[model samples]
Target chain A: MAENKIEIRNLYKAFGKKKVLNGVDLDVKKGESLVVIGGSGTGKSVLIKCIQGLLIPDSGSIKIDGVETVETSENIHEKMGMLFQGAALFDSLSVWENVAFVPLGKGKMSKKDAKTEAIRVLRQVGLAPDVADLSPAELSGGMQKRVGLARAIITKPEIIFFDEPTTGLDPIMADVINDLIIESARGLGATTLTITHDMASARKIADRIAMLYHGKIIWIGTVKEMENSDNPYLQQFITGNAQGPIQVEV
Target chain B: MLKKTLGTFLQTLGKAPLAFIINLGYFTQFVAKSVYNCFMPPFYFRLFGMQFLNIGFYSLPVVGLTTLFAGMVIAIQTYSGISEYGAESVVASVVLISVTRELAPVLSALMVAGRIGAAMAAEIGTMRVTEQIDALITLSANPFRYLIAPRIWAAIIVMPLLVLFGDIIGIFGGYLVGVYKLDFNPANYITNTMDFMKSTDIIMGMVKAGVFGFIISVMGCYHGYRSKGGAQGVGEATTNAVVTASILILIANYLITELFFAR
Candidate 1:
């Protein structure tokens, strides 16, 4: 693999008595896109949370650039960025302030300079400079997602995480977000890990896809392998079939 | 009947002591970190000003009114109790000492604990639920320094002053009762209050108020800082902060009283 930028080995997590992330092992190569797909409640979110240090895994080794990060995710995460599912923008700060959050911390840039750079980052994500002065609440769902994506890339970190990037968008909006995701990840040459079940999004943005079912990564392959895989779990999920060893709830 | 009884038994059996231990561990860690950060660099006075407006200035009216009524009732009760000994002239001095040393600070803390402490818990608990706290931490700001420190500093700074303000108003409330209602000699009332009040009583009340302030701030921040779930969780934290703080203030009042007056 291209000198594995992100490596997870035998990762496990659980909440209360129920185990999630039962021995999840995956790797994302340098500058490549890895998308994890799963039905809801398959611990996809929990896995990303473990990777981001938001949730502590029960047992695992998550190494970024060959450095074990289980004990130091907070320190490790400075080189990483995340776009949460809800876009989880700070309602108290203006759009530019949210976009410029990390830059404001470095003490290397003045507020005036940070504002300029925030506008520049927003523009790169297809948002106008005027929108930078507004709050996240003033934007539509798609626009908020854009703002979130702008924020995730503004720091130009080595890795970016998208949690269900296209869950609540219209088909056209979803396509727009997908294009933004591809463009942003490519422009920065940042390794990206996205979690979603949107088949179209998976096809458009994933270089490699992993399907998570029953708290384990069941299948993983490139997009071409995804289309032709004979694995029943992969087929049942991709076709959204009701009869292939997967039961429907009422 | 058997199924319902078994279900209740299972639910109770499920809750072990581990969660409380987890919560206590987090609480102690937060308190230690807050104390550490309180002495650290990058103190923000601007944020402290906003919290002063929140915890002290906004809380004055309620404290003032509650203490006033409290003093009035104390005056009337002392007047009745000492009448049995024909020592009604001791009413002014009694009211002054009790209000300044015990009633003003303890009651003011309880009132402010109910108002500001609960509001702080609810506000920060909501922030915890909404990821605002995580956002702050990610921005390289010390959450304790930015959020908890301003609150702790404001409470410690403003509460003694609130107690002082309350003492004056409460003494005045007693004046109204003594001079107008009971027809005690106005000159004797003023002289009695001026003669009997000691600087130790005032200073002791101020000291107690400051400690109570720290307790209220810590409890509010502790409960709220660890809040989970959604809106309902925030509401429960607010309620718990108020209830626990009020009870603590009462217990601490007794302890402080025994320390000061037992000898």
Candidate 2:
């Protein structure tokens, strides 16, 4: 059994009267790629935010290497990097500046050195060095995502979170992102927690899959077990059925 | 029916003050945090330099033009109005007092609130909605230090300088109108303006500019930081920043004037 690098227990969060994460509990082992699958508005992103310490849970415990996160210092974030859903590149910054933001802002490197390192990381993410000085607004959706990926991995954090990694991309671009995610995680040997409803990406990348339904991880297993599972909700979600125990609000 | 109507009216009336107090408390806390972060370490000089350019250097032309026109208008009006009693010479003194003590700082701040304040709100609001602000947090950078403090500091430092320029241009405008347009002797007009000027007048205007600058930047950051929804929300924050900053500048102008000049 692999050692658990992340442990979440009884996480509860609510916005107004709507309870988003009712009692989410899950764990990801060391160096494991855990992809959380859920329907829209099923609290998958909220779950990721809770783990990232962006949104504080109303009640719960989130532990990273057994250190409780809630109300703790911001030191935990230093060990983690996240790729936001929209890429969220700073529009004011150039491609290289956005990628080198953390290092430059932290005063860890000179501007020239940071620019050099940024170009190297951008190249690692399959971008050319020529694209370095262009602003984020000048890039296409696919290129922006690549730049965001470069920014996320530039710090070489021990743990990485990918929020809706392939959102708003064409199928070919989505596949390319999936391949890059797998390659990057492997290269870093980092524990990764990716939240997305994209089954193809999940199947291609996840060492273990967890399905969040009504804010709970109701199913957890290998990709094959997920495909062969007898659970009705999991089956309905995987099959994309309209008539299932998980009712669509629409 | 009468009792129900009265009860509803009373409840509505009671809720307004309660909401006002609650909002005031939250705004106070936000300002407290921003001030605390301003004095803390890890200051971003690059961001500060960019804001100075945006708020101070870029605003120079508009502020200069506005004050110039303001001084010219005051000279013409005061000369025409007071000339009936054969007191056109008082025009120089009036223009100097009005521009240095009141018109320059207030008008310049209002212009900046419209320009820099709205832009700050919209830019920060977009960042909030798009999750760039969250990205900063995950990168372990305090948003206040990286984003808010630099803007506030730039506004404070740059405002007085802008107002000082506005005063110079304003006085020059009066000089043009008095000597060239109004047929007053250039030396007499210059001496009258000089004799009437006091250091306290310019100092008071600079003090008001500094306060107005703080208010404008704070409103922009507050509204933008709390913005939600999407594009519509950001638009609303931009509008609110300008409107609130303008109103606050007027109110603060009166209060500061009272503090300086009240008998």
Candidate 3:
């Protein structure tokens, strides 16, 4: 068996009376890409946040590299990078400054050298070096997403999380982002966890697919298995049907 | 129906104090964390400079104008009030003591609380809404250290300096009114002002400035950091920061005065 890079077991999270993640258990092996598909408000984002330690789970265990993360004092995110939905770039900072934020803020590199590194990563994301000095507000939506991608991979982290990476893009732009994500993650040989309702993105990037329904993982398999599976929940989701075991809650 | 209403009312009453205590505990932890981070390494000196420029230098015009008008008005009012008893000379002393001991520090702090406190809350609250703050944490940086510490330090350092400048401008305002408007001997007015001014009074004013500065920045940061939802949340945070800072400044002014001058 390959080494599991991330292991989440019996995870549960809720806000007030609303339960988001109810006993979710999953694992991502090293260098594999896992895409979680779920409807809106089905706890996809919360699950990723719980894994990133952004939200404390109400109960259960999350182990990164076999060490329990709950209440641990270690800096688990040092090896992790994420591209937030909407890009979430610092409006106050320029492109290179945003890309170099981690190293610069941590005092690990000089500004000049960090900018140089930023330009290099921007190029890898198919952006020109001249785009380095432009503030994030100056960039278009597509360009902003590219910059966010560049920042995520700037540190060449061992694990990357992409949250709704193609939600707001056009079809062509979405395809470009999906391709870039695959290339970048493959280039670093990094493990990745992506959450999106975009099936095109999932099909293009996922090595294995999981379906989350009502805060539980209803199906887990390869893309081929997902396509061939007889699971009604997965079938209802993949077909985009409203009438099924999953209620639209409209 | 009556029982249900009574139960609901009792529950709300019971929850209010608990909620207040919880929020107070959170604010105390925030302050302790920020203070501890202020002395740690990896300090962002550039951010410190930016905050100082924002909190101190930009605040000069407002602080200067407010204190100037206050001093002039105090001089004019004192002249009219004391002249009723044929004690016109007391105008110089009254204006001098009031400006140095009360007007300069308190008024300048209130002005800053309006400007800088609201600004800090809006800026940080926007960051929170946009996920930039969470981005900082995911990037392995402590938001408190990177965001809050520098502002707190800048406010504490610059507030006293701003108040000092306000004192000078305020005293000069009094001088202008005493010399030009009241037709007093400029030399004797100057002498009475100088003779009545104590170093302790100026020091106390500056000390109050420092405390008020801390309060303004802390309230701003606390509200901003805790803000949730979106634009509406940020707006609420900015308003709360200003309101709480202004009220705390007034309350603290009384407490500090009692500590310094109560007989």
Candidate 4:
């Protein structure tokens, strides 16, 4: 079995009166893809944010490369990349600049070299060289997602997170993004964690799938295993049934 | 029933001061952190330069036009009243002192509070709601260093220069009204203006300008950085930035005046 690249144990996080993550225990092996499936407001984003050190958990342990990362994640941040649900590109910079922001900001590469490198990465993501100079706003939704993917992979991080990378996209574009995610992660051999409610996306990208319900991981298994699992919540979720243990707030 | 009603009333009354204290503490911590980071290494000189141009160079016309009209009004008003007392020369001195020591600094700072402060809030607030700030963190960029510090330093450094420009323009406006409109001897008006003008007055206005600049940028950045919800949240932050900055400028103006000229 591969060694774990990321380990989360007994994670707990809550807002004022609502517990978002209740003792979530998850792990992803080195160079593996793990997708967490949950309904809206079920703390999927919060779980990833805790790992990214964007939100402080109420109690838990998150280890990356065997080092505890709850207190300080600055060093850990260098080994990780994320694609936000909104494709949160810096509007102030050009597309190439956004792609090369990390290297350019760190002064690790000259502007000319960074631009060349950014264009190369953009090409790998299926963007034309002409798209390099345009702003993030000028691109279509699909293109912005590609630019965001390019940015996440440009540094060749050890781990990458995709937060609803397929949300707000057409079915074809969503599939295209799924293919790109596979290609990029496979190319880097990076550990990947993705959170989404899209079952097709989950099945397409996940080596193992976990179901989060009411702040807990109710079930986790391989895609084939998920199909045969008898857990009622998991069964109801995967089937997209309205009659189930889970109740829609609306 | 009466006791419960009184308890609820007291609780409601107490909440305001508690919230005020909490907000003040946050604002203080934010300002202190940003100021400390402003002097740290790996400075973003490019961002600072852009902010300097935006806050300083772009603010010239509004400052110029405002002070010019204010100075003309002072000259006309002072001339009419002082002429009744057969003391027309006091109009020159009054225009010089008031424009330099009070009007230019306050009015220019207020104008900039409306323009730059609101812009800082709206821009950063939008970035916040869209999760761009979180993205920057993942990308290893500190928001304070990359965003707040440049703005704070630019507003502080550029403000006194703006006030100096305002002083010259304002005094000239008074001169225009005094000599051309009032038919006073141009040479006498110039002489009277220079004679009444003390370096202390100009120095005082510059000092006030610098303080006002700090207040404006801090309020704008603080509100924007903390803003949440979405578009409506950004809108609220913009309005709060302008209002708080304007109010603080006025308060600081009085405090600085008392500091410099208290008898």
Top candidate, metric DockQ: 4
Q: Per-residue lDDT for A212-244 in model 4, tens only? A: 999999999999999999999999999999999
lDDT of 1 by residue, A1-250 (tens): 4799989999998888888789999989999999999888889999988877777899989999998886554577678888878787887679998889778766678999999999998998889999999988899999999988888888787899999999999999999999999999999999999999999999999999999887788889999999999999889989988778656546
Query: Model 3 off-target regions past 4 Å?
Result: B84-88
Restricting to chain A, the TM-score for each candidate equals: 0.96, 0.98, 0.98, 0.98
First chain of candidate 3, TM-score: 0.98
lDDT for model 2:
0.93
**Model 2 CA lDDT for position A89:** 95
Q: Ten consecutive residues with minimal summed lDDT in candidate 2 chain B?
A: B80-89
DockQ, candidate 1, vs. native dimer: 0.38
Please report how far candidate 3 places residue B9 from its true position, in Å. 3.0
Indicate the residue-level lDDT of B228 in model 2: 85
Model 2 chain A worst lDDT run, 10 consecutive residues? A69-78
lDDT of 3 by residue, B51-136 (tens): 99999999999999999999999999888776445334588778878998899999999999999999999999999988888888
List all candidate RMSDs to the true structure: 3.2, 2.0, 1.5, 1.4
DockQ comparisons of all candidates to the true complex: 0.38, 0.85, 0.80, 0.91
Which pairs of residues collide in candidate 1? none
lDDT of 1 by residue, B118-146 (tens): 98898789888877776565445677887
